[model samples]
Target: MRFRKFTSSFDTEDRLSITIDDIARPLSSIQSSFEGGKVPSEFVAPLTKFAERYGGGSFSSLFAEGKSARQKQKLVEEFGSVLYSMETEEVKNEETFLIWRDACRDIIDWGLKVDFMLDHLKQAARDFFGYMLRPSGSESSCREIIQMEEAISQLRKKLLHLEQKLGEAREDLHLRLGDDISSDSMSCILGSSWVPQSRASRGLY
Candidate 1:
């Protein structure tokens, strides 16, 4: 199918709608099935390593960057400024309005990154899950791969819930924030090949 542009009119991304279909294809659909335990050349190592090392010391916290000094400082400052404005007076002007709007966008940015990472992890697990299904693999290893797949399943559910909360919260930020925010999140959309179009794609997995 040809790609469509992202231009959602709803506060919540109506992911099934024509507007959101391209940018908000559910993460579960990001990787098409790998028939007969096959995967693309680029994915073999990452998919394999991810399936094995998950839930172990080798894996990193998903929130490390989100909670890092720089990100914390930035979010704190933005929150404080927006809160200060709200406490002092209503945000009526474009400046104060945009400040609040941007603060919300920043929050969305974090959510998007986390969602993207989780999607990547789950997709990696899926690819590896398929890889493990090769006839020569041990039964115990097959069980282990299934376990990882089940664990990763939670990520997609959480992201769906997150998108709902984010959409709801955007109401207070103003209904148009989705439109006002750059098509930046547009870049987060993925196709069946597993390429993430966003800058958030870098180092995601």
Candidate 2:
């Protein structure tokens, strides 16, 4: 996934792209800059929270740990919650919000990929069981198959919930940001060219 970093500018219309290294500078460096009053005082807390949660990791590093579907989903949900909790007033400080919004978008895009992976795994497991037929008629095999099915069911439910939460979080962001938030911006954040699906399409509302 490509990660775009925004430079320090208040004009949202003009984005100055920078390197990920520059964007994901150490938490200590950010705090030091904040203490020197280089950045707005209002940004200190949210930046600190983000650094603590992510260990000042780059977006690529964070999303690269997609080996575990559950971990990926949790990471995406946490990122969304962080974005949702950000102060709307900070939108005026275009650089901060844009950087964070881009991070959120990266997480959402990564989560979508993870969702596909999990769905594939689930289907593969089902196919394996279907091909097993009688499975030697062993009680233990039967129990294990039943357990696997139950686990898949639970995973499916969890993925559905994750989608719902992400949708709601996106809606909250739109409401807070107002007209400034556009389909292009959403697409950028979501890492998808298409606009967000309607409530009916998502089985929401």
Q: What lDDT score belongs to each candidate, Candidate 1 first?
A: 0.40, 0.48
* TM-score of decoy 2: 0.25
Worst 10 residues of 2 by lDDT: 1-10
TM per candidate comes to 0.21, 0.25
Q: Would you list the clashing residue pairs of candidate 2?
A: none
Candidate 2's residue-wise lDDT over 1-205, tens digit each? 0111222232234433642224432233332233123433344555455545554532234456444755554554445334333443222323444455444444556543222322332343344444444457586887888999999999999999999999999889788878788798777766843446545446343
Error of 2 at 126 (Å): 23
Q: Number of clashes in model 2? A: 0
Instruction: Using lDDT, give the best candidate's number.
Output: 2
